[model samples]
Target chain A: MGKHTVVPFGPQHPVLPEPIHLDLELDDEKVVRAIPSIGYIHRGLEKLVEKREFKEYVFIAERICGICAFGHGWGYCKSVEGLMNIEIPLRAKYLRTIWHELSRIHSHLLWLGLMADGMGFESLFMHSWRLREKVLDIFEKTTGGRVIFSACKIGGVRRDIEDSELHGIAEILRGMRDEVREITDIFFKEPTSVSRLKDVGILSKEAAVATCAVGPMVRASGIPLDYRVADTSGVYRELNFTPVTTDTCDCYGRCWVRVQEIFASLDMICQAIEKIPAGDIAVPVKGNPNGEYFARLEQPRGEAFYYVKGNNTTHLTRFRVRTPTNMNLPAMVEALKGCDYADVPMIVLTIDPCISCTER
Target chain B: MGYLSFAGTILGGLFKKPVTTQYPLKPAVLPEELRGRVLIDIQRCISCGMCMRKCPAGAIVVDRSAKSWSINRFACVQCATCVDNCPVKCLRMEPQYAAPGTVKQNETFVKQAAAQPAVAVTLVKGVTPTASAPATGTQAAAASAATAAKTAAAPQTTPPGDGAGHA
Candidate 1:
C-alpha cells in the first residue's frame, strides 16, 4: 500500500470546458475517491424569474447553459405554459422538437470533439468540430443564433421554419451523415481511443441507479431511462422515440451512446420534418400564469427538470432547474473510484459535466 | 484495431482544402437571420415604451417625455425581444453587430421635433397612439414637446426599474 496524496483537479483544466473543481484522493497513481466541489459558476438564474416577467423569463432560462440553451428555454416555457393551461399548436411542438434534435446532434458532435481532444487526438478533435460547424450553420440560418437560440417563447416558437426550409435542413443533415460516420468510426475503431476508453471508468447498472445517474451515463450502464420516452410535452412519442442503451458500463459505452444519439437525433429530425403538420405556430396567451408545474425535458446530455411557480402575477414566484449534470455527479464520483489518476479527466468527461448548468 | 487506422484520414486531409475560412482575411460569411444589434427608426417611434418594457436585459430606455430611445449595447443580450414587441415597428434587428468599444456608452436616438408634425397628423386621425391618454392631438403633441424640452434641460434621471414601474 502506498501513502495517500490529495490532488486538487480543477476549476481550470485543459480538458474541461466549464470550471469544475474535484479533489482526488490518490494512492500510488490510482484514484481512491473523487470529491467534487461545484458552485463555481452559479449565476442565480432561477432567482431572476422574480425580476423578469413569466413571459420574458424564457430568455433568462435559455442562458442557463449555452450548449443546452434550447432545452432549458423549452423546459421553462413548457412549465409555464402548463401552469397557464395553454395548449400550443401542433406545428409549434413539431418545430420545437426538430430544433431540439438538431441541437442534440450539434451537442453530441461537440462532446465527441472534446472527448477526442481529451484523449490527445487533436486531428480527430478538429474534424469532429468541423462537422459540428455545419450544424451551427444550420442553427444560424434557421434560428439566428448559433449558441444562444432565442427561438423559443412562452406560448410557442418565435419563428416558423418553412416546409421547404425544413426539408433543406433534413437534406443537409443527411448529406453530413456519411462524414459523421467516418469521424465517429475512428472513436470506435482507433486502437489508442479503444484502449483509453474501453474497460475504463466502469459504472455498474446497480451503481448507476443507486447514484441516480441520468442521460448517457445511465444509458451506458444498460438502463433505458430516457425522459423523452415518458415526456408528453414534445412530439417524441409521435416520432416513436426510444432510448439508446449499451451494457458496457464504461467510458467507451458512454461514447458509443452519445455517438449513436447523434445519428438518432438526425433521424428524429428528418422524421419530424416529414410528419410536421401545418397549423398556426402560436396562439395568443392572454393572462398571467397562476400555478406550479414541473416540466421534464430530454437534453442532449440527459434529463433536465424545470419547476416553476406562478402566483397570478407577471413574475413567477419561484423557478428551479435540476440539470442532468447535477444528477450525474454522484454517479460520476462513484465511477471515479479505483480509476487511474491519469484517467480522471477522461472519467470526468464521460459524464459530459456542464458545471454551468449544474451550478445555475 | 490498427494503430494507423487514422492514417488514411490524415493523408486525405492533407490533400483536401482546409474546411475553415480565413475569417478576418476572408471576411467571414454571415447568415441573413443572424441576430446582431438592435436598430431603431426614430421617425416611426411612438414613444410607447413597449421595447423598454419588454427588453429582458433592461438594456433599453424609452423616455416618452424626452421623445428619445436609448439602448446600452453592452447590456443588450441580442434576444430581439424589443424588435418583436415594438408597437410602431420602429425597432429592427440589423445583422451587423455593434463594433466593440473600450467604453460602455448608451446609443440614444431622439425623434426630431421636425418629424413630430407627421406623427401628430397620424395621432390626430383618431389612431389613438397608445403612448398617452386621449387628448386633442395637436395640444398633446405640443405639450409632449414642451415636456421634452423641459426634461432635456434638466439633469438626466435614471429610467424606471425594469418592467416594475409600469405595473
Candidate 2:
C-alpha cells in the first residue's frame, strides 16, 4: 500500500492569476482527493451594498473579476433593474450584448493562453495572448477600458458605438476567426497538446450533473445546460444564441468547448451588430429599487448568479454574487480523484477558475 | 502526427514582424476612445462638486473655499464617472496614461477668483457693518473683500443691497 501524503497547491502558483489554496491528498503519483479552501482574496464586496448607493454599486461589481468585469457589471444592473422594473432601451440591450460577447472572446483567449502556459507550451501561450490583445484593443476602442469597462450603468449603458465603428469591430473579429482557428488547430493536431489533455481529468455526465457543475465544465461533459439558454435573459434569445457542448467529458473536450464558444461569441456579436435597433441607449431611472431580484448571467467561466435585495433606499439591504467557480469546486474535487498528480493543473485549468470572482 | 506540428506556423512567423513593439521608446498608438487619465479645464469649472460626489474611488477633491480641484492619480480608477457627471464639461479624459512614478502625483486645478466688479467694495461695506461687531477694522475689511469677490463672480437674482437690511 502506498503512503498517503497531503500536498498544498497554490495561493500563489505561477499559473493562477488569483489566490486559491487546494490541499490534494495523494496516494503515490495519483491524487486521491482534493480539498479546496477559499477566501484569501475576499474583500467583503457584497457587504458594501449597505454603504454604497445602488447606483454606485455597479462600479464595485465590475471589480469582482477583471476578466468578467462587463458580465458582473451587467448582472448587477440587471438585478437592480429587475427590482426597480426599469426597462432599458433596445439599443442598450444590443450594446450590452456586443460588449459582453467581446468580453467573452477576450476571456476565452486568456484561458486558452493560461492553459497553454500551464501545460508548458510557451509559444502557444504567447500566440494566444497576442490574438487576445486585438480583442482588448476592440474593447478599449469601444468601451474605453481593456479590463474594467465601466461602460455599464443601472438603467442602461454609458456610451454608444457608432454603426460604422461596430462594422469595423465586426471586421476585426472576422479577421480573428482565422487566427483563432490556426491556434485551435495546433491544439487539436499537435501530439504534445493532445497527449497532455486527452484522457486526463475525465468527468462522466452523471457525476457532473450530480455535482451541479455549471458553464463549460458541464458543457464539456455533454450537458447542454447554458445559462444563456436556460434563463433566456437579455438579447441572447434575439441573437440566435446556441450552446456548444461536447460528449467527451475530459480536459481536451473542455478546451474544445471554450474555443468553439469564442467563435460562437464572435458570431453573436456580428449578428447583434447587424440587428441592433436605433434608439436611446439609456433611460433615466428614478427612486430607489425596492424588493429582491435575482440576476443570472453566463460568464466566461459559467453561470454566475447575483441576488440583490433593496429596501426602497439608496443603500441596498443585501447583495450577493454566486460565481461559477464556487459551484464547480465540488466538481473539481470529483474530477481530481484518481487522476495523476501531474494532471492537477491541467484539470484545474479546464474548469477556468476565476478565484477573484469566487472569493468576491 | 508528424515529429513537429508547430513547424508550419513557426516557419510562417519567420518572415512576419514581431507582434509586440518597442513601448515607451516609441509611443504605442492608442485608440481614440481609450480612457486613460482625467484632465480638468479650470477655466470652465463651476465648483459644482459633481465630480467629487460621483467619483466612486473618491479620488477627486473640490475645495469650495479655495476654489481648487485636486485629483490623486493613484487613487483614481479611470472610471470616467467624474468626467461624465461634470455639469460644466470641464473634465476630459486624455488617451495618454499617467506614467508610473515613485512620487504619488496629485494634480490640483485652481481657478483664479474672477475679476471683482468695482461695485463689490460698496456692497461689501453694506453686508458687514462693524458698528455692532467685535471684529477689528482690518479683519472686517479682509472678510468683506473675500465675500465681495465671491459675490461679484456668482450669479445674483437680488441686488447686493438686500444684505443692507441684515447689517
Highest lDDT among the candidates is held by which one?
A: 1
Model 1 DockQ class:
medium
**Model 1, span A1-360: residue lDDT tens:** 998999999999999999999999999999998888988898888788889998888999999999999999999989988988899999999989999998899899999999999999999999999999899999998888999999999789999999999889989999999999999999999999999999999999999989998999999999999989888778988885789999999999999999999988889898999999999999899998887898899998899988988789888899999999999999989999999988898999999989899989
- Score every model by TM-score: 0.89, 0.88
DockQ of all candidate complexes:
0.71, 0.61
Candidate 2: RMSD to truth = 6.4
Compared with the true structure, the alpha-carbon lDDT of candidate 1 equals 0.88
Runs of candidate 2 exceeding 4 Å displacement: B1-19, B116-167
Per-residue lDDT tens digits of candidate 2, residues B57-105? Answer: 8899998667699999999999898888887688999998987889987
Residue-level lDDT tens digits of model 2 in A253-355: 9999999999999899999989998999999999998899988998889999999998889999999999999999899999999999999999888888998
